[model samples]
Target: MTTPFSSLEDYIALPRVESLALSPDGRKAVLTVATLSTDRTSFDRALWEIEADGEGVPRRLTRSAKGESGAAFTGSGDVLFVSGRADASAAEAPDAPQLWLLPSRGGEARCLTRLAGGVSSIAATALDGETVVISADLLPSSRSIEEDAAARKRRTDASITAVFHESYPVRYWDHDLGPGVPHLLALETPGGDELPEVRDSVETGRSADESRGVYPSHLTSPRDLTPTPRRSADTAGQALTPDGRTLIASLRVAEKRSGRFVLVAIDVASGERTSLFDEPGVHVESPVISRDGRRLAFLRAPFHTADAPADQEIWVADIDGGDARRIATDWDRWPSSLVFDRDGTNIIATADHDGRGPIFRLPLDGSAPEQLTTDDFAYTHVAVDASSGDLVALRSSWTRPPHPVRVRADGEVFLLATPAGAPAPLGSITEVATTADDGARVRGWLLLPDGASAETPAPLLLWIHGGPLNSWNAWSWRWNPQLALAKGYAVLLPDPALSTGYGLDFIARGWNAWGAAPYTDLLAITDEAVRRDDIDEDRTAAMGGSFGGYMANWVAGHTDRFRAIVSHASLWALDQFIGTTDNSEFWQTVFTPRGLTENSPHHFVRDIVTPLLVVHGDRDYRVPVGESLRLWSELAEHHADDDGTTPHRFLLFPDENHWVLKPQHAVVWYETVFAFLDQHVHDRAWSRPAQLG
Candidate 1:
């Protein structure tokens, strides 16, 4: 049933919908209709609307917002979005991202905001359509559009060589040289006089110097939005006032420790701010509000984020900022994803306190919370239509791939992702059990290739996600599991030790242990996959990005299980990475009892034996490109030893950063990766490194 192709470019693309949102009336579904770039490895997000019944070829609403996301329809049907609203370069000045207004029926998008500095997120209210609250790169107090992030880091005496990527994610990256210090500077009066600390607006100051070494690469040398020690972090989406008069979200402000966070409510009309929730020495994440707008929910942990709260409990607050409280009196595991019902009678969120993801609901009037869906795997996402209160969620297991289903409160089910006779229904998803090297039962998902059996073992790809702190849920999306599976290779995302929701001890166990037991979980999963009749162990390949990229690099150095490997925005050199990453202090010291400078990939590059493919973004300040070159150079030097070491190739994208957002570059990168796999895994051939246009 698969398309037989001579090269990766001819492969059939994976069909999927992402970021699904419902129209106010619940008659239409608005989602991003995404397809693999013709280049065969990248993806593009276009606005698409489909019937609520999950029928028809979705109507494309807008094609112009290339990198835009988080789309929604106002109560009146006008389209709203958060996108590349401005040139990040203009961030220091008072400009806005290009906020556009698109007609619900269809047409060219109209600009709403000049959108100068980066506008990261936006949302409309259920009560009134025209009102919106957004989060953006506040104007930095500085002015210097000519220096690179590296230069800025250099100017600040930060280690420039190991910083990953060029520009760190605006909110994700903080100015940090070490504990008790911030690498970014606020526009201050230098000298005996202290500059008044301005916390309400983004801060920036102009400097013509191009030598502020090791700043973010994605951002051109320009002004930066100095984080208010109180409003430094933000939420994925905003919740509106019952009357659409305000928007509530979580923001990260500066802290004396490694990471600090604050959740606030902003009046849409007056721009007045209400500090709803604040925790010093703790991190706040994913703040969401209920339908009545009287209650708010979010996740909180330690500032440096090494440990969870005494419990990562779900907390709620009065919209007026009078009385705030905790919803779950006892939370054993971390909580994820929050959503409120149409009438504000119930609050829904995903958590793994039960060992696996089980959707649960808490009553607003103080009723006990109840688990909604019971599954063996994890639920990565949740969707609720406020108009009708219809709910949909995705749950995946180790052996089974992710399946999206419309679920009812009474336990009824209707499959959503499956179309009648759609190539391969998600039904075949399966799981297997493996024991980590330490003998703990670890679960894994298995998706076999089409038209495959024991006699036809297919190539396998060990795909790992970043955020050793993040969990890989069983869900379907365009970027992973789906993309690789469509390309004829089996993909694996094992929930390793450092992974969240397994309880604090399990999560903290992997700390500083770096290349130790956490690796055992991944390898154990691979060992089980190889034991399957349909897997081609000899033709295996491994790939990952960010912290996962660190694992990929570490795996290659520790063993040669795969034929080829790709490391994206990787932290390859521990020492350099600790000193260079935008989160140097956190990753270096806070992430573990020991520091990352002592726990990096550079320590074992000399022992690497696999044929490697190194990929990085010049703008990635999170996991800098230098890590790639360090490993690549070591491989090159090994070959020059007359030792005839295995060959290595490097792929660098100049204008991109941590995540590949550009259409053409994504295609090229995807194609290269698949071609690399085809040579060593499926096609069973090798060739000189050829650049793809």
Candidate 2:
């Protein structure tokens, strides 16, 4: 039997559980699972229900061709989700994702809102179930939902796609920021019968648009909660008080070439806004309201500078913005998420710790945080059962994909029944460590194939993680190492300087000096791994994407130890990347003129002797395609022969962004990567994939 890890088709077809949402009553939990679509070109997400106690068989809740996501429970136990599924009775299909409700009593899901720009995300659902807050895009010229819809309709009819931006960043990651500004809207319950009717004849199905409402049954008119918002409302982290009276949100305050997020409170009924915390050079995010509606807990992080990195400090304050204090002052790890406990006495947080993301319990009394889980797995989407005080989350490690799990207050974890069973093991994983020249500790996770020893050694693939600020502590669908292990390669995921989970001092070691400490750390760790008997040092390769991709380019020019190098969405020229990337402001501060001259990989193209593979997505905005274009041009100018033939190959994804996300594209990505490595590292004949043609 061919395992999922061995066959890319089977791997893409495997069901993936991405998120978990627990009911407040603690009776059931809902999971969002993505499966391969019928065409095999996309993944369709649907909702599944499983018992919170880990006893009942998993049951499918909602299915649609367009898919559903962002599942959250209303106060009345209704499942609120966002979907782009079209309505059969409607005259036209929905152009964007709309809010839908799957009743607690079990019935077909129904559309609730039909704004032209559609819903961005569900901010919060009031505990009383009478009001729900959501974020939606509104044209700056429009004041109400109807006006915004009309404005969008006119733009569509005229085929106008221009956006007038008064902001620093007009684009992010892969897409343009907006012709519309994001605003928080509240939907008050009376079943939508009393709302004013819309007057767009072309929009409503009825002949007399003046006398007809825009939507059919279950239509709820939205009241603007944050009006006159620029670009600040889109990325706000919001939480609603249990009584549905106040909304706590982190709104971005635009600055010169940069921005800072400040926590704010809004009166849901009166639409009044008040600032909670607005300190300079700091960001407040991840607001969580206590169950009793008396307090708020959020993460405060100072902006990073060229000289040093910053830490995320967990802070708590009263609902009225009084009695503020920082908790777990002694904790060194940076928390990625936080949620208040059932009784609001402690905060259940998750942070990266020594190559694993574990749940921690931080008490309100300013005491030390308690480590809850000791396993080598990472947890996400953690939710507390207010009725039972138990916690449920989605957990996974390098050896496994994400699956729903029930965690007790005492840190006991139980695997819940899921439709997606575990795939065959790819290989075994261990640890590798070494000391850098500066006497700093560097470590990484190593995946080794089975039956590898001194007699039959496996080729080592040194995999560098992106983020330069991120850690390889969790499972990644995009940068999975399991596939490499299944192909008889030992994969090494190293966390050099600037990786999180380690103390701030560790990250500072590479501050504005990417090529110095971070570079040496990779070499030191690779040396330690290659020294082992089970690894073949002579057949080693290096590969990375994003920052990792940048490092791969650096390694190719800096050393000849690796047989091959694969750089994906990498930064080739620091001077060019610093100005062209999505956020030029932050990069400008980090890259001094001297640093750019010393660290740029393009400056050392003549030193590269090993075969190289360069992969990039045209839509990538973080590290623009220009970097690779310049690198390719430089490679050809310096190394290409008379026939213009070179060992280096460039794989470009026209439709992909920073990552190749489409199902078909992802398969091709892996196929091309495997072929390149085989040709160079394994000394196999160069065989091009037919799909590339």
> Which candidate wins on lDDT?
2
Candidate 1 residue-wise lDDT, 112-176, digit = tens: 43322334555344544445544443323323322222234343475433433222333344232
Q: Report residue 133 deviation for candidate 2 (angstroms).
A: 1.2
Cα lDDT of model 2 overall? Answer: 0.87
What are the lDDT scores of the predictions, listed in order?
0.59, 0.87
TM-score between candidate 2 and the true structure: 0.96
How well does candidate 2 score on lDDT at residue 443?
95
**For every model in order, what is the number of clashing pairs?**
72, 0
TM-score of each: 0.74, 0.96
| Candidate 2 lDDT, 514-563, residue by residue in tens | 88899999999999999999999999999999999999999999999999
Looking at candidate 1, what is the lDDT of residue 661? 59
